[model samples]
Target: TNLEKRELVELSTRGLSRKEKLIVILYYLEELTMKEIGLVLDLSESRVCQIHHRILFRLKETLERMREDLLG
Candidate 1:
């Protein structure tokens, strides 16, 4: 679990755009709601939701690949 957390921390920021990084930090570290995040970022709430979904998807895919590489 620790390793997973560490990997998430590392992967979440890697090669991310400024907006992506801000979204991650605001949502995870700052515990901001999507609506709040959208307001902070000057994006629509729906767009913020989309970004959050995409970010989670990307993280899941990346973590799966890392797990495969480690095991195989």
Candidate 2:
């Protein structure tokens, strides 16, 4: 499962923009390459990579925040 899907399953609601969600689903769930995602999304490969990184970083941050909230 994609990170966002897992997060969404656990959290029920995702706090990301539409593009971020689409990127996550394509990259992780659909198992698409950056080039493939770019082609499908009408973005450049470099832009897809950037979006992937941003989505990953955002998910990580949200997970950390959730952990802190749970622990504290």
Candidate 3:
């Protein structure tokens, strides 16, 4: 398929710890705002943004590696 669904599934399965995974799911899949995530997690909005950024960057690297594996 051209959509590349497996890429996300592989990253979700292998790359993230429980908390980081939860954060990503809540933000992306659930479409929650950063402020809402902070409220749910009992953190500041800025803290939530920082965590989200860190998690996203880590996932980006993981997915890039997977893409390299697929390509090479």
Candidate 4:
């Protein structure tokens, strides 16, 4: 079910703001380090980590909600 998992992640990303999406792409897709992401975003490394954590938490909630809706 890798395709389904990818679909769910795609759907969840739709709820992200522009900056959040950029951070996700830069970090995961582009394989950027936190320091590199911060340089690209003009933020400190700590801030990038904070944003990353928040994005992950939000995505987790969104994916869970989507799964529940589909199941129901």
Candidate 5:
């Protein structure tokens, strides 16, 4: 679980867009709610939700590929 989280942080910071990175940092590291993030970013709450979902999906896919490579 920690490894996944670490991978998430590493991959997200490097691979995501600027807004996506800010969203991740505000949500995870700074512990902000989607509504709060939306306010800070001047986006709608739903948009923030979408970005968060997309970010997690990308992170998961990357981590899975890394795991498979390590195993193989």
Candidate 6:
């Protein structure tokens, strides 16, 4: 389970933009709060929230695709 989780995170960040990569690393790896991430990235907290949500949606899509590929 741990290995799978690490792989999932790696896969999630593999194709991200630089800013998106940073956000994921900060939020997941560094375990930072969204407000803290916003401060580090010089973005408003709400903006970080928006971007995080978007990132999550993209991840969901990616996961779905991977699941389909695996089940094929």
Predicted model with the maximum lDDT: 5
Question: Judged by TM-score relative to the true structure, which candidate is superior, 1 or 3?
Answer: 1
lDDT of 4: 0.84
Clashes of 6: 0
Overall lDDT per candidate, in order of appearance: 0.86, 0.78, 0.75, 0.84, 0.88, 0.88
Q: Least accurate stretch of 10 residues (summed lDDT) in model 5?
A: 2-11
Rank order (by lDDT, best first) = 5, 6, 1, 4, 2, 3
- Across 1-72, the per-residue lDDT of candidate 5 in tens digits comes to 767776767666887899999998889877899999999999999999999999889888988999999999
Scored against the true structure, residue 8 in model 2 reaches a CA lDDT of 66
Q: After superposition, how far is residue 71 of candidate 1 from its true place, in Å?
A: 0.7
Q: Per-candidate TM vs. native?
A: 0.82, 0.77, 0.69, 0.78, 0.83, 0.81
RMSD of each: 3.3, 3.5, 4.0, 3.4, 3.5, 2.4
Pairs that clash in candidate 1: none
How would you encode candidate 6's per-residue C-alpha lDDT over 1-72 as one tens digit per residue?
767766767888877889888888888877899999999999999999999899999989988999999999
lDDT for position 10 in model 6: 82
> Candidate 3 — which residues are off by over 4 angstroms?
1-13
Name the TM-score of candidate 4.
0.78
Shift of residue 23 alpha carbon in model 5, Å: 0.4
- Candidate 1: segments with Cα more than 4 A from true spot: 1-11
In terms of lDDT, model 5 sits at 0.88
lDDT of 3 by residue, 1-72 (tens): 423544664456465676667677677667799899888888898998988788768878877998999999
Model 2's lDDT to the true fold? 0.78
TM-score winner? 5
Q: For model 5, state the Cα shift of residue 35 in Å.
A: 0.4
Candidate 2, residues 5-64, lDDT tens digits: the string is 678643522777777777777776678999998999899999989977887787788889
Error of 4 at 51 (Å): 0.5
